[model samples]
Target chain A: MKKLINDKERFLSDMLDGLKQRDPHIEIIEDTVVVRKEKKSSGVALVSGGGSGHEPAHAGYVSQGMLDGAVCGEVFTSPTPDKVLAAIKAVDNGDGVLLIIKNYSGDVMNFEMAQEMAEAEGHHVASVVVRDDVAIDNEEQRRGVAGTVVVHKYAGYLAEQGASLDDIVKKVKEMMSTLYSIGMAIHPCLVPTTGEYGFDLAEDEMEIGIGIHGEKGISREKSASVDKIVNRLLDELFKHTDSSRLIVMVNGMGATPESELSIVTKYVMEALDDRGITVSKLLVGDYMTALDMQGFSLTILDEDDEVLEALDADTGSKYFK
Target chain B: MKKLINDKERFLSDMLDGLKQRDPHIEIIEDTVVVRKEKKSSGVALVSGGGSGHEPAHAGYVSQGMLDGAVCGEVFTSPTPDKVLAAIKAVDNGDGVLLIIKNYSGDVMNFEMAQEMAEAEGHHVASVVVRDDVAIDNEEQRRGVAGTVVVHKYAGYLAEQGASLDDIVKKVKEMMSTLYSIGMAIHPCLVPTTGEYGFDLAEDEMEIGIGIHGEKGISREKSASVDKIVNRLLDELFKHTDSSRLIVMVNGMGATPESELSIVTKYVMEALDDRGITVSKLLVGDYMTALDMQGFSLTILDEDDEVLEALDADTGSKYFK
Candidate 1:
């Protein structure tokens, strides 16, 4: 595989080393967990994490006004329960901790197990699962994708405001109900460890409703124009929410150029405008990604005063801006 | 090529449409120039631009403390002199304007023409050309790459501080002397308009010192590990600057994954540490891109007290952080 890496075994550790070095405010612990250098003395701590490839998601969100810690796993793999527990313990300062778990089977299981272990140690911990990906017909089977970044931002904002763990969990869960995301990929990414493409695609084909881990999407069809592809994705999302105003995120699935994302953004905004919907906030760039997949995802969240306030609030996150 | 675009002819306009939609603070004028919605009233205005594919370079840097305006050209083509003059007229206040031009034959010529036109129109204009790319042996012919962003940030900071146009030009010219940059590409990028790859590269080969416009580099060799590639690039940069402390920017060439960039970052920091050099600032991610090219560039600038203060200054820029 043509990737800028050394031994596959060292990918996670080496990436974390670079993260810590770039931001002095970020501290690495247990070789897999990243937390704030200065712990908040009070307030419910926010912690989130998953596989390593969807960078700037969990780790890049770590800061005072965002996530307090992130538990990282190997590329496209779930972190161990011990690592998650370490992040919870490292950030919790008595007000309790909130774990933001993306709705993937492995991630949900591991994060839940860590929550149990933390509670067994007498720390109050609450968890919220983000199943915002609308690709799957069955809601429970949906895979959380770029919408998870919005979860971190909103929940982290609540935590920074000194909200109780239970309140933060309740609000985040409420917000997830209004969040929906779907992605399409023209090229599949190679799994660094396996040294193989996640899936094969003919030159003229594209995958719709693809997952962030490079999983096969709901369907494969002939490539189409940006407007057609965006209309299809938004058609799926429109079925889930009828909100007149929304907060939109045009996220790139690694390797997609920012120029393309901006082009995608234009179509998305035009599509929404035609439907007489207003976009309250728009974020266009890569937030979550599949190693080197080339595609884009569109996420829409129902606009609310609290949601807008949280997203607009100041944050120390180096990536969110 | 599998790209998310509607019409090749509408590439520049569509991208700018999305940019304006996302940030209401930005205004699109003359069909090609991007200026701040609220222009500065007194301080010298900073205006820069070139080709359209380098997202967030000239346009994304437009804000209160970064750039006052950006004149966008067609994909991989320099902006017309009329567009450059339009940008100058749009952002120029009574304090005059400063143009940051990257050292490309077409760009320098067009921006110089625009400068003369603006001067004849009675607007005081100053221009600085950045020749920071160390890929070419001759300093005069070096192409400005990602290091142009540093020039934007540093000079923008000075402009925001109310520095005189002449002083800003003088300081920026001095700063350019100590800046160095180099890039390498593994896979060639397909220029949308041309419908062809910029250069040819085998699966096992890579190009060193590749230009942002997809121009061929100085050498081609078998792809190596991330550490080795970074060392080779740094070896060239080390010959130019002997500064003990430096500000480093690890820029992805459009399609490189952030995980890979972080891994590259790890090796860069480690190499500098082993060499007894200290990194005072670190900026990573896709700051300057080459339209989905698979590679990255390293930019290093000498660290000075004034440079640090400018780099650390706050800005309304959405991408610089």
Candidate 2:
């Protein structure tokens, strides 16, 4: 539990400073508290941001092929509306801006408030609230999890190509229609300050549909067979899906091994094949992580070839392909 | 424990197969079973490889800015010399080749024997064997760990620019003299087969100088404060380093968290700063991870701005920059 931070309070600032040093193309605005890099097209800009624990997500994706700006909140917490609005405005070209947000209540509300404020400032803006987690039962209220990655990809891809606000919103709506994700945890990850676990599970057990913030999953069980566990997840998820072509992901929760993830991927691929779903693209590694939680998530998105090609595009991060 | 692999034996092959699918640039030779990209570099082929568990060490570095060829082996086992030599010959461009190696006994013997074989075959090949583990002893016989990253950067930078074998060797000698690394583990990692742990340690205790292959380390003690652990590791590592101007790394052993790694990084920066070292650069995350192992390591390289600039360069893998 010993850590190497200078101070728990300053860790965010110091880390951001270090990140800025490595990529001078990024502009860290203290006034707005947003991270921005120049974009080539003067079009509708895409803004995506949330907690800081998920490295290479909002920030790492802020490159030429992805988001124009990313706003990072304290770990697991949503960025304030002020920061979100600032990021939206910073990257907003005359065309408009699109906010891709997770479906968490706080995150959705904050991004919505930012959208309202941006509209007040005469900026054309729309939002795509991503609720991709398939682990929960009440479809109307299921929590968002790793499926946010799809939003980062589609939203950013659309915005980078000068898609209009309406076009971007339509694209994100299409994306959300096809995306589904479910995750399990073997252990609770700690917030840096508390060093207290965010959640708990027995050493031999796992909880499905666990929230990244360590929210209790819908169900718990002694860790079952890989095929059984993957099937259990697929049973809940695939029954609701409407398509057969998919982009499958077996993501690590920060602490699982890549080798182990590939192992999980084997079962996932087999399960998808058994169900007659054609996996057009695949990613089996830590794309979105939950601090130090020891487990992995299965994200399945039934998408067309365009989305699959975008997902398969070259990336710049340690975990992503 | 519930991995989805077909069989533990074919796990590595499956992973490589997936990697090949995603990266059409890399080619696997059936004749010698060597994996490499078809980047037609007429310069000497820069080849490096080791066990499979320590992902990305050799393969991930095979993009345009990095290595030319990489040979893969089973988990925690060195690739045969024939495979290594085959990779060398396949990529050899008459200018001679540079084999960058970690200091594991298996890796050293295999690569050394390959070097002799390559030289005997009229290839002007030289090598830079890296032994940067500061955990145990900074002697000739000590093992190597995360400092292989440093070697990867310099060796790849030189090799990419078509540096001759002699030039790359001389450069690595100068660079090797200035880098050192030390690591500690909280729990032993589970190997695929037999599900056996690398070593045994009490839950409340930790082992310092942990080898990536789970070799015995230097110190075993009750977990201490992050600052204390950093100081202890620094006392041993800086004993033979000029880390006054350093590229500091706080790397996780697979299962450690960025939350935990950042904590360790704070202590690392403090310990080095207290000793009057000017922090030239910092990389905090999982670079070289032991498969599903719980622990962290600290690597310091006395680097100039040139080295930092090169390190900042992009690689095709997930986690650089």
lDDT winner among the candidates?
1
lDDT by residue (B1-321, candidate 2, tens digit) is 534345677767776665565455677774324345565547656778788777556675676666777778888888899989888888786877788888788888999999899889998877777888866553787676777876777677766667777877887788788778888887778787656788988746888888887765787888776778778888877788654677887777887765556456656766777899887777766667778787888888776766776687666545454
Of the candidates shown, which would achieve the greatest DockQ relative to the real structure? 1
Candidate RMSDs in order = 1.1, 3.7
lDDT of 1 by residue, B176-247 (tens): 889999999988887889878999998899999999998999999999998999899999999997888999
- Cα lDDT of model 1 overall? 0.90
> Over 4 Å off in model 1, which ranges?
none
Separately for all candidates shown, the number of backbone clashes (residues 3 or more apart, or on different chains) is 0, 14
lDDT: worst 10-residue window of model 1 chain B: B312-321
Identify the CAPRI category of the predicted complex in candidate 1: medium
Minimum summed lDDT over a 10-residue window in model 2 chain B is located at: B30-39
Candidate No. with top TM-score: 1
TM for every model, in the order presented, reads 0.98, 0.86
Instruction: Enumerate the candidates' DockQ scores in order.
Output: 0.78, 0.35
